[model samples]
Target: MHVPDGFINTPVSVAAGVAAAAAVAVSLRGARRELDERTAPLAGLVAAFIFAVQMLNFPVAAGTSGHLLGGALAAILVGPYTGVLCVSVVLLMQGILFADGGLTALGVNISVMGVVTVVTAYAIFRGLLKVLPPGRRTVTAAAFAGALLSVPAAATAFTGIYALGGTTDVAIGKVFTAMVGVHVLIGIGEAAITAATVGAVIAVRPDLVHGARGLAAPLKLRVDGRLVDAPAAAAPVPAAARSTRKVWATGLVTALVLAGFVSFYASASPDGLEKVAADKGIDQKAEEHAAAGSPLADYSVKDVDDARLSGGLAGVIGVGATVAVGSGIFWTVRRRRTDEPAAAEPSAA
Candidate 1:
């Protein structure tokens, strides 16, 4: 849900900005541990993929549609900290470039869509993994459930935020009920997308999937009629599997295809938040986006006449810019982690 400007008051918006900033700061530090050579680039791809998939809004209800929130998918594919950053990156790009999300409400969107979804979904995912039998199916099932819940969780969060700082006078209970109700339908779509994507990645490169990392049970040996943990073995990494180039290229191509062409077929109805806001009078005070003058505003090129070409070009540009910026940020984070000085071993007495 891209919260537009004027939906929230200045003080509450600023407070949300501070909270979002703090969360990002913490995530950046946590991401240092999560990012590595293999994952850093893949993380960027995940962000780009999320951006692309979000463009394809599926119909959820009569007048409302839903898009991939990307929190559960990202957390399952990468790590939670990086997942938050991934969604944040997409939000940033959409706000500044596409003029989709409002600049003034950037913090509110990030807090509700990025942090809340990632935290809630990842917690549920991990919890389900702990209880469910370990397997690829289990991973996918957990991801589905996590994603299913994350959408409504984010909607509930927005409802709470609105109760605190909503610009218009509306019934808090009505807003909450509507937001959660519509988003619950949206969550079904989210769950399907997340589960399918996670399953696909796990099938191709389970090594790259952070949540699926430990699926392979540790070897056990029976000695003297007692079971003992076998010594860890260094499995040989295939040259092809070791290189993420193929996977990266494949993912980028998929994102390009989706955003550039497939997006044209996406549902044109308002998304869950927009529909809810309109129904509940929340958009009465919504202000125009600051970037409305941008050439690429509203996901269309300014001078391009052909609707398909303009929209496609804008989508391609968005995907390219998002990947470039996301990759740069993740690469820098990865390098910072690797370049740190190693702890020196203590000298023998």
Candidate 2:
């Protein structure tokens, strides 16, 4: 959830900020191992896709809606470290450009929505993959389960944080109950989206999906009447399939359509956190976003009379900006991975 300003006290907010910064720093290092020439660009596309899908909030309850948190989806598509970075990028863009999440609470949002979700979901996803039968179906199923649980996990984390630093004096039990209960319904939507997206990617380019890596059963060879595990033959790739260009172009187009047009039909009700805050009086101390005056504030373009057009343009801009920033970050990380060897070697022998 996008925690706005004034919800958490200054000290806790700062603590959360430190925690989020630490998480991002660790992820940057871990991402070096995960990012390669092919995956680096796909990582950026994944971020843009998450940004687009987040705009299409589906109705969860009478007054509450939910959207893709993207933790499990990103982790399954790319890797856990990169997934955290992806969500963080989206949150940052939304905060500074769209005035959606509060700048002061950026750390809180990243901790709950980015770090917690990614860690929880990836752990569960990998754990499931360990026990379940190896197959694309199992991978998708595990992704669904991981995504389903991640939302409530995030809610629980937020509840704990609020218990420590909540601005208003609300019953902690009621807040927790309401937050978890509604988010359970929201989790169903998250599960479906994560599963479907993961399934689709696995179907097209399983090679590109980090979670699906090594999913193919090893080649079995019969030697001396005993079947032995053998190295799987490298499958020949056509000149076209080798490049990530097709996948990247397709994903970008899909993101553009979802944000630019499909988001218009998304539910208008407040999301899970907003609804809970309003209902429990937790929002009493909520402050206005610092970027409320920005041209793209509130996901609408300034001076744009047409509601549909304004929102569409804002969404498109958000997708473009997120992709650009995410790609730059990932490209830098990938370069670090490549440069490590040279830096380690002695120069001028």
Candidate 3:
């Protein structure tokens, strides 16, 4: 959920900003180890896709809706570090260009939405994969579970943060219950989207999925009644996986379609956080967004009277801008990945 300004006090907001800054710094370093030629470019696409999907909020309950948080989906498709950066990029774009999330509460949103979600989901995903069967099925299953958990985890983190620095005097226990309860329903949608997206990619180009890397079991042979690992490397990379342009183009097209057209049918009700805040009085002190005067404020292109055209144009612009910013950041990180550990193909992930 995108925390707006005035929800938390100045001190706590500043503290969250510092924490977010440190996490982003560390993630930048970690992403250097995660990104390379092939996967580095996909980072942008992942961010854009997340931005696009988030616009299509599905109804979760009466007067409540939910959208993709993208942490698990991004982490399963890319790496955790890069996934953090991807969500952060989307937050930044939404804050500045769309005036959706507030500039003052940027850190809070990044901390709860980006870092908390990515960390929680990636941990669960890897843990599940370690115990389950090693294949695309395992990856998809882990993704679904990871995504399901991450939403509530993020809501819990917000509750904790609010307990410490909430601007209002509302009962934190009630907020906690409402936030977690509503987000639990949202998590189901998140799980389905994550599993389906990851499954689709794995079906065509499992090699492109960072979480599925080395998932193929090592070859084994029976010699003298003793099973031993084969000396040969694993399976060969399919031609589809080797060529990055086709997949990249396909992802961009899909993102465009989702944001530009499909978003029109998305539920118009408030999201989980907004509903909870309004219900619990946490939004009593909420302040106007600093960028509210921007031309693209509220995700509607300025000077466009047609609701459909304005929203669609704004969505397209958001996707294009997010991809550009995310690609530049990831490309810079990939260039500085010279000191990483050796690998068969650094970019293949």
Q: Pick the candidate with the highest lDDT.
A: 2
Please, what is the whole-model Cα lDDT of each candidate in the order they appear?
Answer: 0.92, 0.93, 0.93
Q: Alpha-carbon error at 287 in model 3, in Å?
A: 0.4
Badly placed stretches (over 4 Å) of model 3 are: 217-241, 339-349
Q: In model 2, what lDDT does residue 261 have?
A: 98
**Steric clash pairs (candidate 1):** none
- Compared with the true structure, model 3 gives a TM-score of 0.91
Ranking of candidates on TM-score, top first: 2, 1, 3
Q: How do these models rank on lDDT, best leading? A: 2, 3, 1
Write one digit per residue (lDDT tens) for candidate 1, span 21-112.
Answer: 99999999899999888899989899999999999999988978999999989888889999999999999999999999889899999999
Clashing pairs in 3: none
User: RMSD to native for every prediction?
Assistant: 4.3, 3.5, 5.5
Worst 10 residues of 1 by lDDT: 339-348
